[model samples]
Target: MTKERVLRFGRAQHLIGVAGLPAAPAPTGSVGIIVLNAGMVYRVGPFRLHVEITRRLNACGYPTLRFDLSTLGDSGASNESQSRAQQIRADVADAMSLLASHAGCTRFVLLGLCSGAQNAHIVAVDEPRVAGAIFLDGYAYRTLGFHLRHYLPRLHSAALWHRFISRKLQAAANQRGDDVFAVSFPPRDQVRRELTDMLDRGLRLHFIYSGGVTRYFNHPRQFRECFGRLASRPEISACQFEGTDHTYALQVDRQRLLQEVEGWLQRNFPTSDGSTA
Candidate 1:
């Protein structure tokens, strides 16, 4: 594992990372993958998620760079007043640029969790170098609404997210007014449509889902439909894993999950799949 305190856009200090590649020649020049971590600021729990996943991915013979999006972790924007959209997009572009400058990673395979996935989709849509993307327990699918749709029952039994949402809704009501919450953000459903429509051409997308989520929120069928709508030559797919919740990487089924991603790497970035490029 190699950690670099590099300067991304705006001279923000970033703990850029590369972990889990064996002590062998790792595809000289360009890198095979760039793994993204989601929502680091929202909760510290995601820290464990990013770290563990990077460890597993590296152990599985995949070298990865787990970066902090602007203002979220290490990379702070040029001006503090950067919008979320600008910050997120800049962070991603900075990552891709870093890959080229440091590792000779001409193109990157983007992987992000939840909001990170959303940002990755944003980056991939514009940059053609992004070959593929993996949404790990992602929430921005047009099929599923924003944030906690997968937690609703009609899709999966009211397991985790429903209760979490209920509490959040109550908290919002307690703190502010209906109009405030309603108008404060974009409807989650819109996020999906906008995201899919923004996809890059021929970008192979892999949605790895577990948490028993179905149509009511973010179901497998819904994801497929959304992907179908957005991608002209989209290689989109959905798969299910049993007994897992939204934060699948934390208590996420480790063995099977790793295999799923490993297989995905083989099909997508084969040279990074414990084999010679």
Candidate 2:
């Protein structure tokens, strides 16, 4: 059995979230899992993915919290002036503190998708309490292989040529405003350095990509290509679901992702008694 409750936390109690707790005590070494908002979406995640993930982890004896960022969803805006990135990191830290006080969780694992994944990476790299992170459609850089795989197949399609010409024409027009929901990728070298630092500190990292970002990441091996020798680290694992959309819209795709997450947790953070808590 599992239990859940509403939580309001953060500096001014401006954050809102749901916490899923196991019926029995969590495993001796289980880490609390924090699920962040996907883009501008609420804590429920796209198609209630966050809710599903929280329940599944709860069943395995892990406490999970799914919450909105400072200005997104039900959370109130922050009064302090800070960059969006700073606000995100502060919000994540506040979440960890909340879980620590509420569930006695000293360690954490972050789970996110798309923009949420980027936030997870930012927080996990700097926060010492983060034991692991699961990133879906996270930071990806174009490689020689990516260019070949992306353009070669489309060369024969007349539609591609038409679209290319259309894009060129559109490029001459005035630029649009920045999209608040769109993710801004940091430098690849910076990300690679942070990833190396996290791995050196024994953090477990999982990178999963869907077909939605096929333009940037197509195959599983592309992870290796993007990060170079760092991809060879034993602490890192990755998967590519070729047909799955960015949000795992299909039921079957969602199920597959859930199963993968469960398996990774079991393999990396099993209970002391050799059973799921």
Candidate 3:
């Protein structure tokens, strides 16, 4: 059986969270898991994905916590003057501390989607207590293969051609300066170095991308292409659900995502009896 409790705690500011506790005993060295907020969405996650994931992980004998980071969900805002990055890092640390104090869990796995994925990566780098991290639709950089794969299929579509021409004509009429879409992706080399360092520290990393970020990512190999040799590291795993949207809007997509993450967790952090951790 899985039990859930809603609670609040913080160091600088209070944050709301739900703790998912498993009736079954967790394995020795079992680490707790924490799910972070995705963008402005509450701790429940897009379509309550976090809630579902936490329940499932709890059933698998891993206690889980899903929480809002000050001002996102039911939490109050922080009065601190820290930068956004600093605030998120501190908030994650607090969550870890709370889980440790309450659950006797010193190690943790952090999970996030989109902007939350960015925060998870940052925290995994700074916090040694983070044993693993699952990044959903996280940092992505385009590569030559991505460009080819992106444009090749569209080239055969008359609608795409018409839309392309229409967009160009609109751009010409507006006399707009260099048409650059404002998208942010982390620096490739910097992320590679960070991943290398984390892997060296024995951090298990899992990356999942969806079709929703096609503007930046399209194929599975794009991640490997962006990070070069680091992608081949045994500790690193990547998956692309090209048919699914960013939030796994469809129920089937959501289930597939849950299965993928559960399997990854089992493989990377399995219990002594060979069950999911």
Candidate 4:
């Protein structure tokens, strides 16, 4: 059995959160999980993925917390004038402290999607308490293979050819102007360095990409390409759902996503006392 409860605690501000706990007391050293927001969608996650994940994890004897950031969902705004990155790190740290005080959990795993994934990565790099992290539809950089596969198929489509020509002419017309299509992603070298340091510290990382990000990540090998040899480290795992959308909107896709994550957690962070049967 699993029990759900609302939690409100923060330093210098109040944030809203929900905790899922097993009916029986968790064993000593049991790891808890924290799910971050995906953009502004609140802590419920896209399609309520966070809710399902927390409940399932609790049933398996691992406590879980899904919380809303300041001004998002049920959380109130903070008066601190900290940068977004600083505020996220502080909020996550506060969540970890709350779990430690309330549940006796010292170790934690962080999970997130999209922008939340970026924050998870940032925190995991600096926070030693994070034992594992799962990033869904997170950072991605284009590789040569992606470009080839992406444009090769479009070559056969007349509509694509017309659009391409129009875009080329538009680019020529705006050669001296700033690029309007530019998008922001973390620098590749910095991400690689941080991933390397995290892995060296024995951190477990799992990355899952969906078809929703095909424009940036089209194949399973792109992660390796972007991160270089670090992607092949045994502590790191990557998966690509070429058919599923970012949110796993389809019932079957969502189930598959859940199974993949649960299997990963069981393998990497097994129960210390074999209590999760």
TM-score winner among the candidates? 2
Error of 1 at 41 (Å): 4.4
lDDT of 1: 0.56
Q: Which residue pairs does candidate 2 place in steric collision?
A: none
Query: What's the C-alpha lDDT at position 209 in model 4?
Result: 94
- Lowest-lDDT window of 10 residues in candidate 4? 177-186
lDDT per residue as tens, model 3, 1-277: 8778888888855888988877765555788899998888899998999988998888888888999997888998778998888888888888988777666677899999987888899898879899999999888888999899878978799998887689679868977554222236678889888989999999999999987788788888888889988899899989899878888889999999999988888888887778756
Query: Which residue pairs in candidate 1 collide?
Result: 20-58, 30-104, 30-105, 31-105, 142-192, 248-252
Could you say which candidate leads in lDDT? 2
lDDT (C-alpha) at residue 227 in model 2 = 97
Candidates in order, TM-scores: namely 0.67, 0.90, 0.90, 0.89
lDDT of prediction 2 = 0.87
Comparison by TM-score, 3 against 4, better one:
3
Question: How many clashing residue pairs, candidate 3?
Answer: 0
* Better structure of 1 and 2 per lDDT: 2
Instruction: Please tell me which model should have the higher lDDT, number 1 or number 3.
Output: 3
Candidate 3, residue 202: lDDT? 96
TM-score of 3: 0.90
Off by over 4 Å in 4: 157-183, 275-277
Error of 4 at 240 (Å): 0.7
Give the per-residue lDDT digits (tens) of candidate 1, residues 1-277: 4443334432454434443343443564334566665555431225365556556655544555666665556554456566777766666676666656554556577877655666676677667677778876655334435234443443565655676678679867787442211112246566556455434355577877666333233445555455455533436666766567555544537567767877876766666544532
